[model samples]
Target chain A: MARTIIPFGPQHPVLPEPLHLKLVCEDEIVKEAIPALGYVHRGLEKLAEIRDFNQMIQVVERVCGICSMLHSQCYCQGIEEMMGVEIPERAKYLRTVWSELHRMHSHLLWLGLFADAFGFESLFMQFWRIRERIMDLNEATAGSRVIVSVNVVGGVRQDLTPEQCSWILTEVAQAGKEIKAIQSTMLSDYTVCKRTKGVAALTKEQAYELGAAGPTLRASGVAQDMRQLKYAAFDKIDFEPVVEYDGDCYARGVVRFREALQSIDIIRAAISGMPQGDISVPVKGNPEGEIITRVEQPRGECMYYMKGNGTKFLERVRIRTPTFANVPPLIAFMPGLELADVPVAVLSIDPCISCTER
Target chain B: MIENMKEITLDAVVGEASKMKSDGQRLVALSCTQLDADNFDIIYTFDKELVLTNFRVTVPKGSDCPSISGIYFAALLVENEIQDQFGIMFNGLVLDFGRTLYLDEEITTIPMCNNTKAMTVKK
Candidate 1:
């Protein structure tokens, strides 16, 4: 039997990541997928050698604009731990509030794109419309929509006022209700289920061994989430990893959909239990030695490895993004998939090539 | 700092990774940092029950570290990226990108290594 090698994309209709997959196929079914990345490689990690450590905070935020807050939060947390800076309690809650907002918007953005990937234009618009309200909240409260630059080494740079917090609560409550209205359409509709259910199914063992993270791992029933590490005000809130036993594309969709609504509750908790204190503290010295910090980003567990030499410049800053960790799992299950199913399956990982190549 | 990190020689990578696998650890991330012009510290992070166990292997520049892809299978992509970035090669890589994972054939400067310019295509 002869095998045909087909190029999937360096350009796709949807997905923020530009991935090129050389799909080896026997007729319509794929046998292996060899990925070619670096189309979006920015070498942001190497900036650590030149840029000052504090300046790198801004640099890391640009790694992935959608989850920029989580990126900076993870990086700053590692530096804070190294410098022994205990942030203010209010700062912790503020950070958690913004992180969940970013998570909700990120998940909604992904859901819209996922729907559009399969030609559900109407559903796409609905998800994005709901997402706009979250964006409005971010811009109104934090002064920006996409890359909310609220995180600093000691604490956050911005604080939510009483009226702003009240507005946010109202907005998110409405957003959660809107998400509930479309829950059946996104999850159980004939069109969505036909394309996603049982497509590119990955078992629990494969997902774990291949190093899947975030919802990709959770959708497979691993029950693992980096938020369990209790960074920020997550310790003060009640949370659980959303698990789906099917481990298919639809399960991945449900996890993100439910997480968007869950993000609403998390934001509510953070706002309600938030203490009154300073938003930031004074930092004394440079971070010395190496430390690794992990955070639950919209995609998955984002790890930051920072090494300081008692200087403004860090020796190295290695970022192992969720998409980077999730790629192997995506490739693991790609071999047995239909060529037509490749796009939906790849989008399922919520591939962020910039984060991966950075 | 690095907790639960056992220092090992380069050749012991596969053996240590195999042991971690048998213990039911998930291969999380492999971070490679240049110590100097001479060596790189390879940190293998594994998670079991949400607890991280790490193994550090210090390999001299241009040395061949045994590939853990055979054991973890997830080590393939990171191994290739390390191969491209630091100019360190992995023995028995499941899919060796031959230092072209991110770099083109024309630009040869090792990007992650110090004192060498990370070459980009003239666009």
Candidate 2:
């Protein structure tokens, strides 16, 4: 037996983050892999102990730039459950709209990153160009491109007027048309098919037993989305979980692509069905109970367990991030792939390092 | 989808809790806090999703709560954390543990609690 070691990141040019992967290869085939984290541990969880409950929403948003809105929403929902406060219908719709927008942008960002990973610079640029439209909508709606600090404990701080809501709906519709074209190109593109087809395949049983969630599990043909539980006015609005079979890299890519389109549809429905009500609801009394909250983020399902003991600060905050649940399954996927395809194979799972390290 | 997931409460299993040893269960986190001057509350989350239903057990102050670390793998770490932060004690947990969230070796008692005072000394 022969072995060789290869280091792949912590400052790699291609990867956007400092995700370092040490690969043990045997003749261009990876046999074992080890992922080294803690590069961006900014003590987000530890900061929760000091930051006020209202301020921790912003702190948790900083946990991951790509999925900031969902992070804040999850944190806020947990606090809301502890306080037993119900948000207004209009605020719920606004949250659903922004959440869908964030999902679209995040999936498109991941799609571009995956394209660039396979050295398809042209496809990458195309996907990113469309992503710019969604970013513009985010900035116009929430006053920030990435970290949209609209979520509070009970409701959203930002309210969408009729004009702003219409403008977002029109722009999102146009973006949806552009995404359809991009999807057609992606599905038929020969290079993408050749590189990703049948690579890093995981069986349905393996996906479920390892606790993989969101698109990864959806790609394996499991319709297990937390949103299906009708969270955040989703029961009022109409939407469906996008799923695909095959459970390969191509299948994961297609699932995300289709989800990006579905998010646009969900946003359109939310904006069109935007009801009339107050945006922010005041929370009273100290939180003094234990509640479990789950939300479907772009990556997968994120759960927060919060316990409050009738104080301004919480007694304990436990986060089960999607990446942490996905890591074990990702490690299980790396054993039987060629060395050259490792990066794309890992990217197929959409590893959010900050979420995992948090 | 698996519907009607079975649930077991912590209050019912308080006395005869040794039945956990026959199962491959482990502790995920043990959190504690002083809710008021009269009583303190401690919570233990177990990794029961695989073998049993994952449940959180709450123990109030002055009660001889049973320690489940002997049957669980990571219960000792969580026990040490609760002891370090809330000044609570587990009868036989391995102590003198390294700090996971705090820097000072001698610091104990919940830092986030309203009762704990901030110490400031001139360098």
Q: In TM-score terms, which candidate is top?
A: 1
Model 1 pairs in collision:
none
- How does model 1 fare in lDDT? 0.90
Displacement of residue B76 (Cα, Å) in model 2 is: 16
Error of 1 at A127 (Å): 0.3
Q: Local error of candidate 1 at A47, Å?
A: 0.6
Query: Would you estimate the TM-scores of all the predictions?
Result: 0.97, 0.80
Docking verdict class for candidate 1: high
Top-DockQ candidate index: 1
The candidate maximizing lDDT is 1
lDDT value for candidate 2? 0.73
Give DockQ for candidates 1 onward, in order: 0.80, 0.09
The local lDDT score (0 to 100) that residue A150 gets in candidate 2 is 92
**lDDT per residue (tens digit) for residues A157-200 in model 1:** 98899999999999999999999999989988999999999998
